[model samples]
Target: MTLPLFPLNTVLFPGCRLDLQIFEARYVDMIGRCMKTDSGFGVVAIVEGDEVGSAPGEFARTGCEARIRDWQQRPNGMLGIRVEGGRRFRVSSAQVQPDQLTVAEVEWLDDQPEKPLTVEHDDLATLLGALSLHPMVASLEMGGEVKGQQDLACQLAYLLPFGLAQKQVLLEMDDPTVRLARIQVLLEQLQGDLTA
Candidate 1:
């Protein structure tokens, strides 16, 4: 399917929430079109270049589909929108339009069947629960409970301070078990760094 791409410096995961401020003409127009059509857009992580003015130098082929949930016009003269991440997709090809909007032909990633959280995931789930208490995380409204392995993995991966490339790896993984394992390793590395 063809998708309009929004290349940013961050990665989005399914079942996660992201609030975006829209001001640039290209993106404002894109958001308007998406809202009007009740369609979603692809949010790819920028491997290089800035988020504003001109197309990104390069971006990860894998990304999440962003569905608009709420929108408002801010007093600061910008459009504010809350979006929920829907599905993962890989861009096959992309090009910049005259308006500098990036559009791509993308293939949706296969959905992994939902798996219940194993006992091994309890610590990670607890970590996510603790994360939810922070004011900033609370503001994202990521929801109250972990539903399954995919949900848990996505929420933690989205909220953590992991690098863009690391998050992109998590986004591209199709197996919840493997994704959670990778997250565990990353968390251990983080803990090691902290202790050192």
Candidate 2:
């Protein structure tokens, strides 16, 4: 299916969550259009340029099909939207539609199988315990809430001030097991930093 493409510097995976401020004139229109119809949007990892372009090979191949879970009109008059990530998709090609949104030919990625990887849940526990100690996270009261394994991994990856390269790595990983492994490594690194 083809969709209106919205490319950003950040990458989103399926079953994750993202909050965005829709202040840009083009995207404000896009959000309104989506709300009027299916209430969904296509989020692509930005390679270059400000908006999704016509070149088929230009944008990142993989992205997430996201739904607007909640919308709020900010005091500044722009919209604040909380989007829930739905599924992964690859942009085959895109073109600007008359309504001012860029439409992309896309193929959605399938959900990866749950694997019985030999994980010590203690690793995750250690990480969350450490994160709870951070002043910023503590102030936000994100410490005690129970996040599922997959959600925990994704949320930590999102909140960590990691570089773009690390984020791209998480996006490129197709298997949940592998993604969990990468998260484990990142958690270990963060734990090491705390001890140092």
Candidate 3:
């Protein structure tokens, strides 16, 4: 399917929330079209480039669909939209419009079966609970409670302080168990640093 692409410096995982301030004419028009059509846009991590202005950039081929959850007009005349990450997809081809809006043909990633929260997830869940209390995280309304191990794994992988590349890796992983295992290792290393 074809999608309007929004390349950002951050990686957006399925089931996470992203808040964007739309100012540029290209995106302003894109959001308007999406809302009118009741469709969503694709969000990819920018390998290189600025979010504003005409900046030549490279973006990851894999990304998530961002469905608008709420929208409002800002006092500064900007569009404020809160979006929740939807399905994962891989971009097959991309084209940029003269107005700097990127559009791409993408393939949707399939959802994996749900897994129960295992004992392996205990530390990561605790960490996620603590992180969720932070003001920035709290604003996303993710809260401490969520359903399924897959959901918890995806959210934590997105919320953690991992680099863009690392987060991208997590986003590309199809298995929640493997993702949680990777997160547990990262969490252990982070905790180890604290004690030293």
Candidate 4:
């Protein structure tokens, strides 16, 4: 499928919500067209270069589809839109238009069948519960209940202070169980560093 790309410094995982402020002419036009057609744009994490300037020099090959959930003209004069992440996709090829917008041919990544949370996931679920209570997370209004392993993994990967590269790795993984296990190890490392 062909998708207009929004390369950013952050990674967006499926089933998560991200609020974006669109100011650039290229993106503003892109978002308008998406909303009109009830289509979505691909959001890829930038590996190099800035979000507001020329097209990013490099970005991850994998990205999430962003479907706009809400939009309004912000008091700051930018278009504020709330988007929910949809499918995962791998970019096969991309090209920059004269307007500097990157469009890509991508293949949707297959999602693993949903698996219920097991005993081992209890700790991770608890941690997510605590994180959800924070003012910032609460403001996103991400529901309090985790539906399954994929839900648990994606939410944690999106909310935690994991590095961009780490989050991107989690996003690309096809197995929810493996993603959760990796997150557990990363969490341990994060705690260890905090104490050291």
Best by lDDT: 4
Residue pairs with colliding backbones in model 1 are: none
Candidate 2 colliding pairs? none
For 25-119, candidate 4 gives per-residue lDDT tens digits of 99999999999999999999999999998999999999999999999999999999999999999999999999999999999999988999999
Which ten residues in a row are the worst by lDDT in model 3?
48-57
The segments of candidate 2 whose C-alpha lies over 4 angstroms from its true place after superposition are: 51-58, 97-100, 114-119, 125-149, 187-196
Q: Candidate 1's residue-wise lDDT over 74-115, tens digit each?
A: 999999999999999999999999999999999999978899
> Cα RMSDs of all predictions?
0.7, 4.1, 1.4, 0.6
Once superposed on the true structure, which residue ranges of model 4 sit more than 4 Å away at CA? none
Pitting candidate 1 against candidate 2, the one with the higher TM-score is 1
- Judged by whole-model lDDT over C-alpha atoms, candidate 4 comes out at 0.96
Ranking by lDDT: 4, 1, 3, 2
What tens-digit string does per-residue lDDT give for candidate 2 at 48-160? 66543332234577888889878898898879987877777777877866655668888877765544424565566566668878887665445354445555555566557
Model 3 Cα lDDT, one tens digit per residue, 85-153: 999999999999989899999999997878778776777788789988999999998847867778998
Clashes of each: 0, 0, 0, 0
Q: Score candidate 3 by TM-score against the native.
A: 0.94
TM-score of each: 0.98, 0.75, 0.94, 0.99
- The global C-alpha lDDT for each of the candidates, from Candidate 1 onward, is 0.94, 0.70, 0.89, 0.96
Model 2 lDDT, full chain set:
0.70
| Over 4 Å off, model 3 | 192-196
